[model samples]
Target chain A: MRFDKDSLWYPGIGFAVAGLLLAFGQRALNRYSQGMQRSALWVEHTYDVIRTIESLSSAVSRASANRRAYQITGEPSYILEHRHSAADAHSALAALRDLTRDSAFQQKNVLRLEDLVGARLSVMDDLLKAQARGGLDPRKSASLMARARTLDTRIHGLLTSMTRYEEGVLQLRAEEGQIGYRRTRILQYALTMASGLIILVILLRLSKEIADRQKKELDLRNSTVLMEVVIEGSSDSVFVKDAESRYLMMNTSGAKMIGRPLDGIIGKTDSELFSPETFARLKASDQEIIQSGRPKVYEYSVALPAGTKTFQSSKAPYRDPQGKIVGVIGIARDVTAQKAAEEKLQEAAQIKADFAAMVSHELRTPLTAIKLVIDMIVDRTLGPVNEEQNSALVTAQRSIDRLSRLINETLDFQKLESGKMEFRVSEADVNRLVQEVVISFEPVAKGRSITLLTNVAKDLPKVRCDKDKITQVVTNLLSNALKFTAGPITVSTAMDGSDVRVSVKDSGPGVSPEDQTRLFQSFVQLEGTRSIQGGTGLGLAISKKIIERHDGKIGIQSKVGDGATFFFTLPVDRSA
Target chain B: MSPKRRILIADDDPDILAMLSLRLLKAGYDVVKAAEGSLVLALVRETKPDLVILDYFLPNVKGDEICLQIKADSALRAIPVILLSASTAALPPETVHAIPTDDRLTKPFDISILLEKIRLLLPAESAG
Candidate 1:
């Protein structure tokens, strides 16, 4: 189990406390055992003193019995035995005195017993001498025996008293030793229990720490497995490299990308796997990421066995646990298909552009020639024309104008649909632009006997828009108005909220609601409107796209019988 | 009047050349015509026209290149050039602004507009 630097001291302190408890317990046991040994020694000392006293008493009795035997049988051997018994009594008295030295009362008793034993022996000796001196009178012998008997009784009494005193000391010592032994035993048990509890606590703590470490290890292992699964399951190539640019680890996809096995890729540098040119380029970027400790995203094409594949790879600095940048980790995705699709789309756009250019040149060139020739004849540049001829030429010129308008409308719609129309956006004075469009339509209005009027708001806020495209929209609305209605057409511009609104109100045969919905759609010429003027039907659609591109809205408000107001609004250019 | 002001016109189409020449003649300007782009520069030098009108797409060379050449020549730089193109896409406003031409026009244009451009460029001639 790994112990973090911060937590290492925890177990250390625990062991220290447990050791302290053990030391204290050992001291307590030592003190208790020493007390028990001393108590036991004192008890044995008391028993030794008692045993010496009993032996001394037995020696006195045996000497007196031997003297009596010598007096009865007049045997010299009995006298010798009596002398041996006397020597035994003297040695036993000395031993009792030595053994009782720890107690003043027992020592005094031992000395008194020794003196009485000596007196009793001396009395017996005097009787023996009297017997040796000669056969004496019965009275003299009886007196000597009585004196000896009295001394012996005194000696017996002294011995009995000494034995009783030693027995009392031994009994007191035994009780004290038992009490001390019980106290020490109880103390040792308490210390042992306390030490055991501390040890159990330490063991429990150690086990808990082990369990916690095991759980952490398990969690770490599980997370590593989960991360591996996620990386392996991804379609994108994921890899890690050391600071030296050697491959540290990689997912299966990453290995597959290099066309190598996982074992072969591991510990290998990019230089070993890629061409020198590719390796140099990749190493430069990898070193940059590592040194800068930053993330980079870039696209590169690789030559693979299948084909050249484009990849968008993002690499970031991988940091160690200490937060030091250690290496690079990267993920690369194959974007070859997406790139191919984009190339195809660009090719299609080029084709459409070429087609538009062709239409503009081939069609307009012939039309220009036709219109110029027709204009020369009608304007009398060729010759003077009669009324009939001039009328016919004028009619033909009108037809050409319509055809030209159709061509221009179709081109505008196509450009708008393909998102190729370019707008030179600028801040424009809405009122002036509307007034200019109205004036341009004046000639048409006059010929048609339609009064074209303008209601331009003064000091209207300028709007951001393409001037040419806006002018085209206004022209379309005005032309449509003049064609549909004989009543006066009013073009007005004013602020509608944050936007500048331009409306071409015409007193035309009003459109139905259904036709208004489809009015801005291309190639939808309304029923009555189609017969009145043959329009390309792309005018309104192109105008709608242009207005929308300027972040504006366009619509018409009309009723079945009432006139229609074709209006569009452009957002005011706040910057201006 | 003061030797009619000479105007050089270049176009690949014969009909366009004929119509434009007739109109310019009617409008009282001495008109010079070149059917090919290769002859326009020589024609312009020979005639020393008051102005030059060039179709953007012509045989052998483009109108903008001729206009650039005319503007490049210090002696002929003052002679105004009108670059005309049939394709709006080919001669967008930015391209026209880039080329050092006096003016530009798109084709299928009205004769009045062309006349007006010529008059603006040849203000002194028009007044006389």
Candidate 2:
């Protein structure tokens, strides 16, 4: 285990405890050994005392015998034996005293033994003098022998007691040493076993922790893989950069969108991977995100290997636990389709405006001259006309009328296409509006000698719409019918649900089923037996656009000989 | 007899100049014409006309710039300049008309409006 300074697991603290226990055990063992050594020394001293006491006992007996002999016969052998016994006793007493240095009882017993030996020697001397002087007197010999023998018995008993006391100390010292040894063994075994178990437990826990950490790492890797897959398959380009603005990673879509291979872009900076202008722009954006820690979204057009592309790009800073801005994450969406669509719409609008201007300039020039000529003729500035000439003038007037209608249709088409048509909404009487539109056609229908009729309901609901534009719409439908039909045209108005329906039915060869489908498309004139009468093919298309703008609908139904019916519906007055 | 009234007609289109020339001639006025941008001012300096009809769109010189130049000059600025074009083209009417030009006319203009503009630009008896 690693060391913690304040924890018990601290290496130094553990070492200190171990060292203390070792020192304590060693000191205990040393103390026990020292006691045992002292006891053994005493036991050896006592054993020497027992040996010396036995020798002393033998020496005293010998000396007593020799003194009796010397007292009876005055022989030199008795004196020599007395001297040798005395020397031997003194030497034994000295040796016993040296071994008894730490034991007071043994030393005291040695001293007592020594005193007894001396007394015995002194008593032997007295016995020897008595033997020398009185030569074998029974009474004197008995007295001296009694005194020496008593001293000898006392010394021998004292030495035996001292030896037995040393033996007792030795037995106690041996038992204490055995206990110390067992305690040390148990302590050492326990310390070793605990250390092993602690190490084993630590190792097992560390391995399990390592495995768990590895599993978490593996899961993080899989999540990264999933993120990469999503980025690669997305329509948007996704990329990450390090703090230094070098590419750390980029998805396949990002690489492809940037017109670079993944390997090429992986470690490159914007300066290295993009143009100078683009690089500067990107660097500025990166700095902003890094500085403010906010996301930036902007559109940029880039010329790449594929082609020019426009992208809506968003970039944000990636932060870590400390809220430090570590890197940048960016996503860019390709907007080429939307961009192209917008451009097309603008171009179409401009073209429509241009066409309107062109029509006004081009058509009005000729019409103005024709109108001037017609005005002059009508004012008799050209000359007086005959009856036939006047009749021809009427025909010319009709042709001019048709030309004016065509011009109006072209203008309407231009307005509709440019989305510039402005409708003036108002409450209009539907029946009156229909009758007014049909009345405008009465002159043309009478000129053609075609019967024109109106079937407007008296109770028809008033429609909320632009009256003039709606009247123009009805007139256009009626005029188309008059131009296409030969016989008669019936103008009718009715109520249909929330709408007011107006229909112009003409008795003529009707529009074909195929042509009917494309009838309202601009510039689509049906190929039929009916004469176009110099018509611009924009009337139906303009009418349809006008109706649609009012939130209404226009439709047509026809059979070959049963005549064609052009119908339109406008919403009834809900405000009323 | 009174002197014929002098009129300067400036246009990029030659056909418009010819048509205008015939009309102005029929109206009994002396017509001086210039078709290019560079020639208009030189002609104006030479012939100080009573009236000038200028086309808004020109090949080399902008109509507004020409109007400014004409108006800026002390000698020729008094002549009435009528500007005409197929499209309004966002040329300010007041500014062009304020350049000592009595009128501004858009092309495909009604002949009656044109006659009225011309008559209005001249003194009542002098227009005849």
Candidate 3:
């Protein structure tokens, strides 16, 4: 509703300018109209003046003809006619004088014309008196007629001057009317052009303003429709609440969430639509968003017609164009199925850990008895035996030993999976630990005619770790190497940056890259690996877990053709 | 004029008990065996053996309880009692230090090493 200064003021100035131009045009048109009217009146007056002068001239000629008739016939009717013409001539002259009353120059001509007309009348009257007295002598009458003729000629001369003067006045008045007509036409043209220009500018401005307003209104309407569509189309519930905590707007999903129509939901506070407890919780969060101007996220469980469902909702402060926080806007999504799935997975994992612990313990009980009996036989405590018997007993002892190790690995994996693996960290020499594990595997290596090489880096840094776990890791790696390789095996220790790395390399068939990726996962024995090789397939998994618990990295580096090197790196002790 | 050393063995498994006793008897010690947890204490009191070997998962009383019982009795408290278990989980702190038996051993021990440890704990008793 508010317009910027430029947008408001520019059109205002245009209208104001157009208004001024129209006013000026109106005034000029009025002036020209009046001028044309006055010129028309002047032209009429000039024609009236000329017509009166002509009437006066015709009346004087009639008077002179009647006076002469009276002189010759001594007729009273002629005298009367002469008096009537004289009276008409006198009236015409009076009208001419009245019409020229405003012009000093024309008035002078009227006075002279009047004086000649009187002189002609007096001469006619003198002759009439002489004729009435007695028939005068012929010589005396001739002289009298001669005097009248002379006066009459002077009168006609004066009439001609008056007529010519009136003609000149009429001509000049007609030319003035023509000039006024041209002046009025030019004024009208200028007014029309000026008014046209003003109207054009005004119309252009008005149309542009109208079009812009229409465009803005259309854009607003389209966006509103688009927003409504998007909000309704979404599966998540969308809503807006006012500062009073009343529902200002809600999409269909939002209304459906409340189990009400949009009309029923709008303008209602949570107290009206939800339980009192729900209202209080919602109001608190709404206030928090308005006060802090930050979004709030929370989850809640709701029991509906279907089942108990969990939803995570996020609310943010809604602001106006001036950036004043007006209300809260929010969206909520159903997470019931996902939460249920996670709980089920957690329960299954728990059952798995329990089963592993139970089976390991059960297997250990019998294993312990068998191991003890085997120990007794091998110890020669029961009786001395042949070399073959002794060897057979020792083999039984080794198998028991392997069974015990497998049980421990399962238990260890269970502990690791449950995140209950406790490490008793202590400082230990990495090189010496590697040496001990290598020596343990040496007997098996000799039986296979494989050389076991130990390359211990001088001054190899010590690391903090559970000694037994690290020993288990090295032992598994060395065992794995011995089982696979016909060529010499090298166990090496070196300082790798901040970590102390111990690696076992076997010149056996190297693991493929695809298989190496899943090598450490439980139950994922590589194709080249075997059950006859006496692997529980848990050794590498347990080793990876141990190394990770010590915050180290374990991996293999090799290709299909090259021999494989299995390595684990532990962080070097920083205290030194 | 020193008396022959006598060692007592206890386990729920009769086979384990017989095998361990035979090993100890052959190692030149008079071995008394008990297959039940309930008989260990009575036998230990009667025989006054130089050393006692008790399994943790006993039927009547646990090895730690036996250790506690022996420690409670001053006359038998000096007898070295070694508690054996199949698991390596550390004993409860109170049970580890409060009862604080002579020592503890994980089951399925190497016979030679077990003998060495026993000899070390009972230097004078086993020497004869």
Candidate 4:
């Protein structure tokens, strides 16, 4: 089973088990030592009994020797010594009995020893009484002495038996203590070994747990360092707020953004850090995000110590591990430079548009005068003009017309580029518009010896567009065809899906695939066409813009040696 | 025949004013010309011309202001106005319609078209 090292229960249970084992081992040791002590006391008791028995025997022998000496020397001091020795023997026998009381066999032997000791002492007394009557014959003394010898022999035999019995008892007690001491010693060793094993296991497990925990702590520290690096390295401001909208943590950039130090910003609420008005706005937004658990991207300008700078901040609800919204995390980018650059670019475009307008106006005034004067001259209003003079004036009028067209194209392109071109949108009939433009181009086509045809589809849908712009596009297309080729030019309109498609087809040298891509770009007159046709190249670009503004598409389809078809599609006025 | 159907023309450019006056004269209409915007209104009130052709941008006064003034005036409101502009981007067709003029034309226009617009504005019997 895998133990939860963090749980108190694992270590608690382990310590409890270890404690219980130690307690058991300690009790076993206590019992073993107690057993050893009791055994030692028993052995000492056995030894004491043996010693008393030996002393009693020795005392009896000494008393007999003293009596014999008294009988030979007939001294009073010898009799007194014999009496003392008999008393000592009697007392020793009593001590032996007392010591042997715990054992039935030893007690019986001791009692018998006591009886022997008493009889011997009485015999000695009898001898002494006989000796005291000193006038007796040798026979009488010999008989008394012989009776005493019988008693002494019996006493000696009994004392020897008692000593042997006591010795056997001491031997038995020593063997019994030896066995008890061995058993106690084995128990102590077993208990000590078991306790030691349990303690070792506990120590090993605790050390392993500590090592594992240390590794995990190291991993946590490393990841924390990595996250700190990422947050601190960012140029954009990164911050986190607490539930009360107080700053919980902020990166260096965040502190810089607020014009405050990191320590000053952390744990401080927005109200404390920002002006009251700014605080109110920031708090409301933060509260909204936290409450809704949604993210927001907004642009706001703050007056920093450096200057007023705009920031585009993206904030999301900061959720905890359980997915509860705790606060908000935000990353704010300084967009001051980007916004200023955009504004500068817009200003420059406006200035360019203004310059184009002024130039067009200045050029048009003179061109208008020249065209009016030339038209009257060509029409013979001033004076009669000769044929050659009229032809040259007509050529000049055409050149003036080209110049006017160039100015108009340049102005139109500029207006379109600046997004200032206004469209007067209305529903216009595509078929009629195509026919009108084609009819207008008829004289020019006739002069060039090219037929102008209108192949307009029947029941075509009307398109929503600026009619004048569309007319200009068609006129440009027709005039381009006339200038490029003498082949018949056909202007056709038809319904292509939900759009009205107008195509101007001419048998001109077709545009190359490479040139077709750049054809609609401003100021891009093709290589061959630039020399052959003197024109401003903004015609197709302006037409593309106009068509695109109407939510239409304009393009060309041609192959080398094949006639080119310039087509445009305007969405049908579905509202009608 | 009908007192030559007088027309008032205003332009800042002398060449434009001279050319337009000559063209209108050749087209058989009496022409009153003003090179500056400050003179056009007086000429209109004095001549009571059948039509007034105005250049949209002129010195001292803009063309729309004069048009608005002419339109505001009870006496001159009936006189037809044709505003001519050198810059079409500034005065788009919608803006032209917003101004109370009989017609609007871009500069460097065909003289025939201008003549046609004048004829349409004037009564047929008074048309040159």
Candidate 5:
């Protein structure tokens, strides 16, 4: 019923005009039909008059013929003919008078015809009587026949005129009837076409509406299928709960998280899946989020059957269409590995601290002996001293110095592990550093009657490294060799792959395979090391760390009962 | 000058034994030496030095054992015994006195500190 007025055609106006035109046309047709009724009656009366006149003419003509024949033949049959003709003429005259009663023009014609028929009948009777008299009167009979013929002709003319008038009236009525039929048929056809058009329009609108509805329904179905796929196919656990806080849905991961069979968590509370203490905490957190209508995220640590583990959890309030908080949702991730690394770091820190304390305690005893003797000598407390005593004092001082060196090395190793060792790098002569170390061990080699030898590659490059630390490395190796061997200790240097290599060799019982593996470990002693010579067992370990810090390497080569050679490499004129 | 009071000392360090004996003798006390803790009790009985200085952690007998043995003997118990150890901090007061050592001297002590400690252990007249 609502229309857009900007349209070109006003269909409502067109329909109203067509309806008015049809009403006017129908009224005109009804009025014309009323007039036609009167016309029909006139035509019917005219037709009746015409039929009467024709019958009267035929009767007169027959009477005239019989009269003539009877006269000529001198027979009595003529008399019968005259009688029949008179009766027929009289009845036809009555009928014609009745038909023309309502039509004055037609009535005049009918009365004239009736008069003619009567005169004719009288003439015929006269003629017949004369014939019966049997007097030879041929002329009289013929004259009478002529009179009859004239009367017949006059009647025929009147009848023919009446028929012509009635036919004209009937032709006018038929033309009006044709016009009415055409108008009625056209109206019927127009009504049928309009109704069909309306029906077609209705069907088209309904089909379009159905198509739109089907499209919307199909979209809704597709989205519903997509949502189902997302929920079912996700790797993370997904779940939902009703307003009453009962488990309404759960995905596979959610089921595993609760440590239950798939779909077993339905209708179960958090309390059923967790320990009582954990359940209480979870419920409290859930309530907090639900009440605040905001998401709350946190992490929790739990002791499972496997081990203690940490879980990062996030929770948010589930809401209804009206935005009323219904329940809560959460996702959790295990963080056990991250927590284990933190614990390991703490344990390492504690070990370093304990090592520092042990080293301090172990070093005090040796320092005490050295200081007591030195104090006595400095104080000149000894009344007299022989050359041998003085020499012994120097030896005691040297032993104490060795003890201090061991303590310093232990401290240095501890510092390296704690990432506190500081390296001061400078350009230094690698050859000279190695030579000085060998000279310092010369006395020890002499005491054991071992030859101390060196091999320096010609034009050896200067190394960019900590000179003092490298010298300490060479000295430590030489000292170990001199302490254990009776034959010879050799120092050698070479250049290989952008680095200078320093090696110290000894003729002594070499390290066992078992001891070699632990040779560079702090506090580790080889098979013969502890019994043959006293060592803190940290020299090789410390030297290895220093070389590695210089971006080089240290290694050992030895066989049981054969001599051992220890070597280290330093970068030459290059820093790494 | 009066003769030095003879002091018998037992220590593993030859430097300490020679040094302390010389110093004590120069201080006007006769000094005797026993280089081993095992010899301290023997020196106390035989040499009968006026005082004994015992070093802890010797090769044979510990200094405290010698101290206890010397104090337990009725004849030698009268001689003052001074104990020297690197771990003087570890010794409990009761354990220190459980031995007959009159005083304790931790190692690396200055010559003056050792002298003061020795003087405290000895009788005033003999220390002078």
Candidate 6:
């Protein structure tokens, strides 16, 4: 096992603990082995001492048997056997003395056994000496035999006690070795299990750390890849600068904008990429965005090989993870073509207005001449006219009036389009004004066989309007109503909240749903049930412009086959 | 009839100038005409017309300028001047209030309206 940092000291401590456990296990096993060795030596020593004692006792008995046989038959070979057995007993006694040197009780027992064996041997020696003299000493032999027998009995008792003590020492040594063996086994198992658990905990912690680190790194890498794709995919030039005003990142378009490679652009300041003048301006704006933590947008033009190009740049503060403003991120879009198109459109509109004014002026003078000539004929100023000639002159005059109206309306619409319409605002007696206008239109309505009805609300609130402009608006609406209508046409006015609502109801073929949508737009003629009594189609458009200038609302309401009511609301004079 | 009270009319258009002169003449007023802005003041001085009709735009001087000059002069100041223009560009309120004229009309105006405006500006005896 190795060390781990995330867990600080866990793995280090774990390994150390495991090492200690291993050392302890080794020590315990070694101690157990040594203890078993010592216990086995003790058992062997005890067995050796017991066997020595037993041999000494058995030699004494063998010597006794040989001495009795020699005494009974006086055989020389039996005498030699007795002498050899006496020697074996002395050596076995000496070995027992050495084996029991550490035990005082075993030493005392050995000494006692040795003395008794010596006395028995001496008694047999005296009898053999007497027999060796060739004299028949039965009584002396019998006496010696009796003394040996007594010594043999005491020696046998001492030998028996020493053997018993030696056998008990061997049994105790074996029991001690068995207990050491069992204790070593228990220690070994405890240490091995603890070390294994420690190692497993260390291993598990190490793998988990690795996996977590790998996953975090993987997420960061994936996000970087995704951001790169988005930045590169966009057509706008995306750029990022660090707090030090050095380029930190530039997308493909951003690099292309400067005609530089990515390597050349990154880490470079704006001064290195842009001209000195442009760089200063760009840096100032960047500083403002970064310091104020606000976004900046501006349109700029650059002279290129393909003439001048315009760009709209948007820059915002770039914040770090903690939301602290660190730099600025800029996105610039090329608007060269769009700006050019807008300029051309404005130029074309100006040209059209100039042409319309010229044409209107040119046409009005001639029309004035024609109308004057007709007026002379109608007035019978030059000469009296026949009824047929007068009637024909009236028809031409009517057509000329229509033509003049179209020219005036077209020019008015142009002036309105160019934001040049002048309005004179004042408080007016709207009710009287409407009455006077209706009275003027009565002759035309009667000649057209259309009844012109009026319903002027009494106590109608005065309104703030351009008197002439409003008059023109109402007159246009009324004329439109008269043109499409022959049935009873109603002109009404009422106080509508803060406004004066004026309406002209015409029993004409109602406008279709689709035509009503663009009814107020220029050049829209509602081809309804009424025959197309020709108009410039600019009348409604001009009227709408006038009403809007007065801060009023204009609209129409009608259904299929139902009469139409064109209404407008002029803001009342509430200042009073 | 007090020698049919005199009037002067100025217009750049030859036809409008002629027609206006004819109308005033038919109304039994001594009519004088000038097709130029400079001629109208001279005609007013020469004929001592009771009224002057000046087109807003003329050859050299503008109708409003001529009206201002006439109103400024002690001699022709009392002679009422009616200004007219062909192009429909109405003067702004500030400019319109700045200029001095008895009446203003757009061209191709009803001849009867002009007659009524003239009759209203003249003395009762001269108008009848």
Residue A411 lDDT in candidate 3: 78
True contacts kept of each: 0.80, 0.11, 0.39, 0.82, 0.43, 0.59
Give me the runs in candidate 1 sitting further than 4 Å from their true place. Answer: A1-27, A58-86, A119-287, A290-293, A297-341, A373-403, A409-427, A441-465, A473-576, B1-7, B18-31, B47-51, B72-80, B91-93, B124-128
lDDT per residue (tens digit) for residues A7-91 in model 4? 5566677677767767776786787678768767876776677677667777888898998898889988988888888888888
lDDT of 1 at A486: 89
Q: How many residue pairs clash in each candidate?
A: 0, 2, 0, 0, 6, 0
Candidates sorted on lDDT, descending? 1, 4, 6, 3, 2, 5
**For residue A14, what is the lDDT in candidate 2?**
50
TM-score attained by model 5: 0.37
Interface RMSD of 5: 6.8
Best by DockQ: 1
- Please provide, for model 5 over A430-461, each residue's C-alpha lDDT reduced to its tens digit, 9 standing for 90 to 100: 88888887877777667777898999998888
Residue B47, candidate 4: alpha-carbon lDDT = 80
RMSD of each: 5.3, 12.6, 6.1, 7.9, 17.8, 7.0
Model 6 has a clash total of: 0
Interface RMSD of each: 1.5, 4.7, 3.1, 1.5, 6.8, 2.3
User: What is candidate 3's lDDT per residue for B1-128, written digit by digit as tens?
Assistant: 56668888888877678777877888888998887777888898999999998887788887778878888898998888887777543333344445566877766666777788788888463343
Better-scoring candidate (TM-score), 5 or 6? 6
- Per-model TM against the reference: 0.77, 0.47, 0.74, 0.69, 0.37, 0.68
Error of 6 at A39 (Å): 8.7
- True-structure RMSD for candidate 6: 7.0
Complex DockQ, candidate 4: 0.58
List-wise, what DockQ does each model earn? 0.68, 0.11, 0.34, 0.58, 0.18, 0.45
Indicate which candidate wins on TM-score: 1
Query: What interface Cα RMSD is found for model 3?
Result: 3.1
Which candidate's lDDT is highest?
1
Per-residue C-alpha lDDT of model 6 across residues A1-576, encoded as one tens digit per residue: 333565667778888999899789889999998887888788778878878877887888888789878978989999999989999999998998888899999888878877888888888777777767875477877777778777877887777777777777777777877887898989988898888888888889878977887887788899989989999999889999988779998899877766678999899998887777777877888888988899989787765444567889999999999999999899999888899999999888878777887788778777888888898889898899999999999989988888888888888888888887777678898898888789989998988888998999999877777888888988999989988877989999998888899999999888777878889998878774235468888889999988887778999998867988999988875442
